[model samples]
Target: MTATAATAATVLPIRGRLRPLGLGDVRITGGFWAERQEVNAVATLAHIEHWLEREGWIRNFDLAVRGGLAQERRGREFSDSEVYKYLEALAWEIGRNGDAGLESRFRAVVRRVAAAQEPDGYLNTKFGRSGQAPRWSDLEWGHELYCVGHLLQAAVARARTRPGADDGLLEVARRAADNVCETFGPDGIDGLCGHAGIEAALVEFARTTDDDRYLAQAALFVDRRGHGRLSDVEFGREYFQDEQPVRQATVLRGHAVRANYLAAGAVDVAVEQKDAGLLDAVRNQWQNAVTRRTYITGGQGSRHQDEAFGGDWVLPPDRAYSETCAGIGSVMVAWRLLLADGDPRYADLIERTLFNVVATSPSADGRSFFYANTLHRREVGTLPDADRPSLRAAASLRAPWFEVSCCPTNVARTLASLTAYVATSDDDGLQLHQYMPGTIEHRRADGRELRVTVTADYPTTGRSGYVSRATKLPATLMFLGRCRCGYPDGRPRARR
Candidate 1:
């Protein structure tokens, strides 16, 4: 037979997005932590709350509001910037619980934090106040705006997703965005954060509100990045995209989390603006960094001091301070890039990080969490004061929260948004990237419910298949094979 004819005869029809197994569908394979009833979704949230309380971080709310502080910080006590992450945690906690009181508590916190904002809509507790740190004074390490941007995003999520959730937080975010737009644009403050979070926050705000202005502001920030507008101080011009445009920067640079988050936001803008060049740049950078620079566990950023990317193939697993947040950030970038180009490789990286790096962060009980996850194990490495060794544990999971706990909630939020990354569509058909037994409801262009039933023995084995029932039209199905294509144990391949 001709090659084309032979391929056409054997190819199976694949359809629908690859949805996750959901909390309900996931049946743990081994009888270890998988068998425990406390490992469920509710239990995870409870563990998160307990850790937050134990770390004395939750009390920062009272300090921000009643204590007359300007902004939350990162220490044991209240810090302005840290408060935003705490709010993000609360938002995720509320999302997990679907609680009525949590919304009220969120609103209360928002109102108190709002009071801390100076007149001009500048809403950072640490800076932007007279007789205190000047507003927008420090862009490199300040993180004042980064914190606010996250709060804005949290507000948007709370306002839209939760039932009986008030628009108060949304209003706060709007005001904050307005302030940011007025201050940080062409005619406003000529600076950007060394930590690249606010841009993504701006894009999210725009998405939540359906306002083009927020998107425009976000684009302006992205365009002005790495052009000396944001200043180049500590790490020189190359640190925070100051050396060249994000497109020209071949390898991932600067702080690992910031670079990935910025790249993700840039992809968001590229998709919205249909900027193909920008999208291409993001994909190239992602591939180069993840494949060469990243740790075996899919963690990025080798050095601890800058929390930044190291040289290519400089992945020292033992010294791997793969920040949990960096892994989350890398996943964020990969997920968006997957949508931008329906490539299955992005999905593979996401799965790798989710199972090995991200899953290893949270303790089995879900109470404690590791700021850094390491693959290597040693007796002395487990000691309390080990200078934060990178690959020091085989699977030494920590509590759900920490003194600088940002990863647990970040993981929670990513998992909550897991539905978005499950599938993608092109002109030809839908592609299923990740396999988990679940039901996917896709509204086709012709206004039909394309119901798909996914069945598989995934992770344990590579074989998987889907059955689709479409309304009003025939659906096209496609399955991109898992990263590891061959069967385990080096046996001959088995057909599904």
Candidate 2:
């Protein structure tokens, strides 16, 4: 069967039910090109280059660089993680739109950075010195391994998407992964990092490299957490560790970004390992957090200090410190959870965050960015200063980028991969979780055309619906039921 007819038939099981859809069918303003432009790629690469040069994010060789890891400052030492993010961004841009100069420049920077690696396969500019610690020694704060993971993933992305792409980056990633496995195995270093990025990155690397060792290493990291194996520091030992088995943790705790990243990584492990218990835990934690602690803007981590979640209903929209990264992290968790359980509510959270908070981060020009976005506004004393300029300005569609601007590039990558979150299936049928105006082309087992044209103005109008016009044979039609309704009155009455 054709994709459209299959989709129509898939809907028949829940003809009267409502389900949410993923970004596969959702189209944001500016689309992929707009995302690239905001990140200063393709049509806007040159302009972004000029701005980055002026802002000092780029060096003499057109290599992307950042000041440091501490509170947004200038003239601090350049971080390997910062460079890795930029390389990932550049690789993504090149993958989408082939630019010889950009690709060459990216490769050159990678080579230079590779040259900085030690003979032990360790690669990081910030901590490779006589007085410094070993590569993975300082897991509590240092992001060297995390940086390597990003580089590895970026290399994989470049290799898969770009023509004539070399395996240099891939080899580097392998070496890095090997180093990590050697250093942090069960008999190796008995610790994890305060930040939980490397686990997710390692999982991606394992998938790309087809190496089970990488996957095992990722699982070990998840399993070892909360056991006091990864070290205990300023954030408290429990901050990094989930305390109980991942399945037992009831609510998201500790550093916001770290918790979410770990949760997402754990979900990845659960799905790949087919651990039903772990998946159930993830769903429980997600529902608990969203219903109680999550911001109305779909933002998490209410505290500005640790960027962690507050108590239930403790959401202070005016004083909201909803970090852009946390919003992105929530989307990642939601998307993966959606794929795991085929639940529409997960997609609902993803859509809400994407449209209102995530979309509001980048300016139209793609230069300035908002690290923190709030849902409401308040005047400070008598000065009337903007409470959350990021959200407000972004809502008004202002600047393109920001000082601590990882959020912009992060959003770019997420939007590019938005196509992956559309639909899912079990042995029974497919589920449509989101309603947007787009065509889904899927082939049915019976060799028919199952094209589904979604027609709806979601989050805007209450009466949006879908029309699945079949091309070959009449198939079953089902509605998964609305997973959520932005309107307080519940599901919008379906219009004819």
Candidate 3:
């Protein structure tokens, strides 16, 4: 990976106030995130793979190939997305450091997935089979589009990291994306996904492929939302964000994960199309959510019944249902906003969520994971059985796996590519957003290069310093704490 791979970041806006560096440009050399990255690479990825195989989620792809999926499908309707997310994590880890073993595992999984694709590019085990539901039959809960979205995202990761590898994952994803565009174009299905992730994934796919059709499809999805196109559920249309137009909605509502995913996609579309109105709408929603609905730990949502957010300021600490996936979604939204607007406040919220919600989900060994993160635990939690999946989503204790295990894979992908979130570059100079022991190396568009080594024992000592050379332009390093210009030799300033 090279400095030119900055376009390979998870969220590479076509144009923004800042440019995010990719895993290639930033390296976590030591300290907090470095340790997390080490554990993620050494333990978390393998653990997820083991459970995915044990739970039969990975085998679901093989069943799809053998035409036994309708009878043998194991996981939930959305289980296929988990496999894609795992592949994405592998792509990033492999890109960061060429892991031959993980590389072999990645290609193996991709082969299984490739064999399942329908002739017309449709792929999924839960629908359009001998005994399964027809494709797109249940728009409210099918998650067919949602699965394809994850597939496209995995392909994007592969394409960026491996560029034209022989694994065939990229081709599989391209076919699926083409199918989506053709099937859901403006004249096609007027309905949008019951879930909101496909929107952002489509936009990113569009960016990756340089195809505006996918972008148009993503825009269509964003516009089609808030129109009550899908049937009302027991939880109501807001659960899917279909009750109000995205551009007109003032605050994020309904399912916390769905709300933030929709907002992140909307920001992508707005930035690509230069839709200021849409951008402002999303910004306002972020502000309102932060001011009212957000927890001090940067968690979102309170209603465990629907896994949705409560009405303005209706937070209950004991009953807080800050799903870990929702926290990741909130980071997705804020990171995009930070790049688009270059606001340090967005980074502040990101740091809070990263330290509290993201880090809190995984146990120390990186094996057990928390599906739902409650701010206060009213009861002492019994140790979950390490051998079995915990059926409880709100369990007080960390579980090795969940029946619906989205967070573990989500954490895997995020941590594998965590270095991308630490730094950004611009025409003027560089900006280091999060401080950890690391090295940031970037090349400007003009061919000049900058390398900076950061040293810190952050959160423990509240002190960090950076030494930068090989650059004539001034670098702006954002510190959440106060800055002391003169400390310990008056050369490198202390940020405390």
lDDT of 3 at 371: 83
TM-score to native of every candidate shown: 0.80, 0.76, 0.96
Report the C-alpha lDDT of model 2 over 205-228, residue by residue, as the tens digit. Answer: 666556778779888988877666
Worst 10 residues of 1 by lDDT: 4-13
Per-residue lDDT of model 3, residues 20-113, tens digit only: 9887788889888888888999999999999999999989988887778878899899999999999999999998888999999999999999
Q: Give the poorly placed runs of model 2, Cα more than 4 Å off.
A: 1-78, 93-105, 230-232, 242-245, 380-404, 425-496
Best by TM-score: 3
- Of 1 and 3, the candidate ahead on lDDT is 3
- On lDDT, who's better, 2 or 3? 3
Q: Pick the winner on lDDT between candidates 1 and 2.
A: 1
Q: Which residue pairs in candidate 3 have backbone atoms (N, alpha carbon, C) closer than 3 angstroms, thus clashing?
A: none
Candidate 2 weakest ten by summed lDDT? 5-14
Runs off by more than 4 Å, candidate 3: 1-6, 481-496
For each candidate, the alpha-carbon lDDT, in order, equals 0.61, 0.59, 0.89
